[model samples]
Target: MRRKKGLSIFQKLFIAFLGVGLITLTISGVVRYRAKKGFIERTIKSQLTDSRERSINYFNRTFTIPIKKDLGFIEQSSSLNNFLTSQRDEALLTKPPAERLFLHFTKMPESIYLSSRFIDSKGREKIITVGKKRVRDYATIDHFPNNVLYRRIYSLFERLKEENVGSILFEGPFRYKNNKHTFVIGISKMEPEIGGFGGAIIFLCDLTGYLNYLSDIKFNQIPIAFVFRPDNHVMLSPEKEASPGPDLYQSQEENINDALFVSSSIKLGSNNNVLLNLALIIPRKIFSSELKNALIDSVLIGVCLIIFVGFVAFFISMRLFAKPIEELSRGTGRIGRGDLDYRIKIETHDEIAQLADEFNRMTESLQKTTVSRDMLIQEVNERKRTEEALKESEEKYRTQFEEALDAIFIADAEKGIIVDCNHAASELVGRAKSELVGKHQQILHPPEEIEGEFSRTYKQHLKEKEGQALEAHIITKNGEIRDVSIKANIFEFKGKKFLQGVFRDFTEQKRSEEEKKKLEAQLQRAQKMEVVGTLAGGVAHDLNNILAGLVSYP
Candidate 1:
């Protein structure tokens, strides 16, 4: 089977350390991003709220509140009232009403007015009007020349009359007599007690220059500033292109997508029909853009940290573990290939050092044991060689004895017992070699002739000076008799006298001699018959001549 491929320990460890570092950095980045996002959101919201509130307060302070205060001062001023009331019976000033009012006030309005119907108790109608330097003709002929301003004041006047309000304050886009558009807050006060029956005073303060000044000053990046009437009519704004105003009665304040919007109605007016709305349209992208930059910066820092951590981890691991482990691996490979002398050289005083010490000791022990075992094996091999030489000699003798043609037996001469026999001897006796041993020598002869033939042969062998040869009839293990030629010798082995006999089987030779005698007898009988036939033939010829003579006499 093929082994599966996989990452090595070094790669796995490196990956584990890198993954941990990267994950930690990524988590930190995420947390930081969330925190920054939240902070930016709150900051943006707070800024928008504060900007909206400040703008509203500034608009009221600069336009609405001052106009109303001026109108109230005019209403409570005893000098202005007495001067205006005396206009019913006498001329309070030789100059026109416009110059006269400007003289009586400490801080004069841009335009001041007495109503057209302000006919004092006398038959003269007193139109006391004063106009700013820019709008000198604002009170000309006791009428507003700008139709837009005329309509706005007329509307507020009608509403104040309907509500029975003494004074009405309103804010709108008013065109000056100079034909220039300006935002203004106006307060029309109807004091029935002062001036006469048709007595009224109108104070108009031009806020267009102030609003334009504010429009040039921006918060961060020029936030959108606009002024709308209560009916959402665009009175003042910085947009070059005019805005498509909302419904005339639209009163809801809402944010548009990513822009934050807030509107504040001027509260200084008793005129419900008119409202001064100051709106700040702050784009939300400012906050998001800042947040995005912060997030990018945080991520960059996190990446740098992760990279630094990875490098540190790599350096530490290489120094502390990798080099030592690599040395151990190489040592293991060398040892596995039978290099018992190889040793791991770890320099650190840690567990690896201990392991190297143990390994070196084991290698030393193995080397020593290997040398000792080699010496012992050499000694054992010498002993084995000697044993093998003896075995070879024994095997040669056994092969000759088993291969002999004649049956050979060794019998103890003193005991008259068979001691050992070859395979041929066992065959001649019709018994196995194992069965022939330890048996009396009489077993080789017939049962009737055993004591006589075997005893004589043994006695002859014992008495003769040399070994003896004899013909003998032996009985096999099955009781069949066979004639064998036997030669016997007396030998002394290990200080004991033993009889050795070599026997040749003669059963086939005796059969052949009997067959030859019968064939010779048959040949003699055939020769005698041949001789008698020759004599009979000659005598018969003579007898035939005599018998011929006797037959002629008949």
Candidate 2:
């Protein structure tokens, strides 16, 4: 199986750093979001409570005193006794007159008043006049007296009379005789001694202005405020009427259970009509909206920042690590493809630099090894060629030796025994090469005589350290004796001493020599006869010449 390439130090380190950074970013972002959310929630809650308290204080300060002074004037007036007894001055005894008298008596800057009369002893009532006589009285009970408002007010008065208290609590609707619209009302009865009136002073209010004021006020801009009221009426906020003018006779019940209710029977005014005080409250929804906005903004900012930072970090980390790693990867590829000379060149002094150095060293060693291996291979090939030439030469020499006519024998120098003999040698010895191989030289001939000669020859060779030639006789395979001429040489080959001999089969040659010697003797005898004849002839010729010379001189 093919092995996978290993990763460089840079690659491994970059991966590790990236993983750690991502984990850290994730953990930090979550922590920041949670911390910011919690802080915003806490801040909103604190501010909302503070704002509610300040609003309530401002509301009480703005309306409470004037309302109390008006009620006080009414309690001190004895004019109500004449008006009730005559009943003819109803138009003069109502609000504008009453309001003007009270305003003058109390020395207040602003005052509002309304008057209602029960013309019949039944439940029907009419609003006589509202503040400044600017509002006209309703014609019938249908115009002013309503079930929810009139019934509740009448019950409150009855209760007040029975208990002999200055005021009674009531919750009901009140109609504006002029605008023909109605609002919820709350009335507090003024004492006869304080106002000289046996009637209730009505407070006209609604949840709209209270809730709106709570929403508008900022806590830090003013003092904090809150309200305590009945809970049931908080959920019963009435729809606002379209009419623009204030309803003097309007009555709004202050439920004791509402968060806006300040007191069940607390004196709102300095006089008899001051039983209910309206305390402002900051709406919980406003605080919740602020908290939500803060939380959302913090989360959005955190997410955007974290993403931006992470992206930058990732790119920076890659630039630091990935570029070097890619360089190393390319270097590795070159090396793997048998480019042992390839090297990584990096200037850093970190672990990657160390790795590059190690790689360079390894490649250097590999180059050296390659050179050495090539040299070794060439040496082996040369040796193999030389061995082949030597083998061929040996085969040629062996073939010539076997086919030669001369008898040749190789003997062991130390043992004086035949080591190897050619075919002719075996024939001359009258034995097979196998039989002659281990035999002593003396065994080839007559034992006593040849042994003595062989001993002399061997001793002579040992002494002179040279070749020796001698005539010898050998017995053939047919039991025939053959004469031979032997030449022996002592040689050393391959660290072993050996004796080599070549013998000519001189049996026929010796006979021819004998015949030639006999022919020479016969030729000598014939040549002597011819020489005697020639000397006789020369003596006869000299005698004949002397006789001839004597005859011619006489």
Candidate 3:
């Protein structure tokens, strides 16, 4: 087998140092990435939420101001309803509210027009229009009207009665018999004093103008703007027919739905085709362009900083690692060429300096060891000779065998015949050493013994060339039985094979173990009886108390 070439101290140190540094750098980069990404996401989401809230407030303020101002004007106008009713001679009185409404339209600005209608208790209705154009002369109670404008007006009145609201926002196409145009209308129920009876004041505003005004508002540099209604209507979308162009209205609807339902931040697209959906229901009012620019700047700055830090780390690692490794390499080369006295001498406070110190100590030890190499080899040879002599001395230990405190014997494997017996063995079996010799060992053992115990042990030792040891009961010459431990080993001396059996009489140990087991069993039985007595006493006391309670109750 070929041995692999070992790495030099410098090579090993360099690899270990680089591995540690790389791991540290990787962990730091991951931590920084997660922290910075979380910060950016949180910041953008907060800003978007704030912007949407502001936009909703702006819309409410702008839309409500004009309505409030117009209501104040109507309140100050001199008995406007009476003036209109008095102007009606019987011929004018019979005029439908729609025609009379045209006369009142002259009083409004060009930006607004009025229409009116009345429904009696019988469900009959009078339709009126008071706008830039006239449509009716005398009052006409109509059961049904085909005009979209009148239908919307009727719906508004019905809603007002049901909800008791002053006005509603309605959007749709309004068609007269002669013309059709899309309109957004605000309708308010007129009090009885305003028009001589209960009726509705409908203000029609052109949808196109309102949409144009909304689009014209500067939303920073946002490329599009639109209005989304609650009913899934795109009031002013950039896409006319949904042909894949950017649809601001749809985007706003999605944002609003998320804001209202999911209440979460949503990302849409990128710079070249940037799409951002800011939830309108958030407390923030979103202006698209300003938020986009802020996010783009943040991302660019973060990326540039990350790259700069990585480059700086790379340069620093090279400077810190390369020079020390080169110096260590030269020192290692000298050591490898039999210059065991060579030492690395680099001064630093890091792991590299510690490595250099360790390398110096190793080299010093190696040099000292080289000086003592011949003496060490001679000492090892003397130890081997001494061990061999010790083994020979042990083989001639016949005196120890005879005088040992423990019983010992030599026997034949097949016949179990004792070839030799020590003084202790003779004393244990109650026979003289001379008498025990040539006697079968099984004569001192029980007949109804563990089957094959000695035979199997002898066979195992013969096959493995190892010794076997076990404890068993044997009968003595006095007919007394005792436990004895027997250790047997196969040995061949002078071409005669024999088994060396060393015996240790353990009769006293066996008696002590039997006494301990009997005491433990008695202790367990005493504990179990004590527990049973306690349980019986508790049960008797409880039963006596229950019997006394029952007798006293009667």
Candidate 1 ranges with C-alpha deviation above 4 Å: 1-24, 28-34, 87-89, 92-99, 102-125, 132-146, 163-165, 178-198, 217-220, 236-255, 271-274, 284-290, 306-554
Model 2, position 464, has a per-residue lDDT of 77
Candidate 2, 1-554: lDDT as tens digits: 99888975555655676676567556865676577656754565555445545655655664455444444444445554343344455656553454455334223224332433322223233233344343344333345455555555556445444443344233432334443222322233443344432455444433344445554554435322222232212211222231111221122322222112122222342233332333333234434566567666766775676567666756655666666667777887898889986888877666667787888888898878978899899999999999999999999988888888999988788777988889988877678898888888766665433543365455555557457677767776676777777778888989989988888898998989999999998999899989988998999999889989988995
Task: Please give the ranking of all candidate structures by TM-score, highest first, separated by commas.
Answer: 1, 3, 2
lDDT of 3 by residue, 1-554 (tens): 99886975545655665566566555755565566556654665555445555544443354335544443344233443443345446435544443443345434554444443334222344334445455444332344555576566556445444433244444444434344234434434344444322443345544344445445533234323444433334444444463122333344323332222112222111111111222222212343344456556755675666567666656665667667877787887887787876678776567777887888888887767866787899999999999999987886687787889988778776667789878998898888888888977666576644244354444444457456567667778878988887677888877777887777888998899999999999999999999999999999999999999999995
* TM-score of every model versus the real structure: 0.42, 0.31, 0.33
Candidate 1 displacement at residue 80 in angstroms: 3.2
Better of 1 and 2 by lDDT: 1
Q: Residue 203 CA error for candidate 2 (Å)? A: 5.0
lDDT of 1 by residue, 64-114 (tens): 665566666655555545565455445445334534444343244443331
lDDT against the true structure, each candidate: 0.65, 0.55, 0.55
CA shift of 247, model 3, Å = 15
Superposed Cα deviation of residue 504, candidate 1 (Å): 99
In terms of lDDT, model 3 sits at 0.55
Better of 2 and 3 by TM-score: 3
What TM-score, to 2 decimals, does candidate 1 have? 0.42
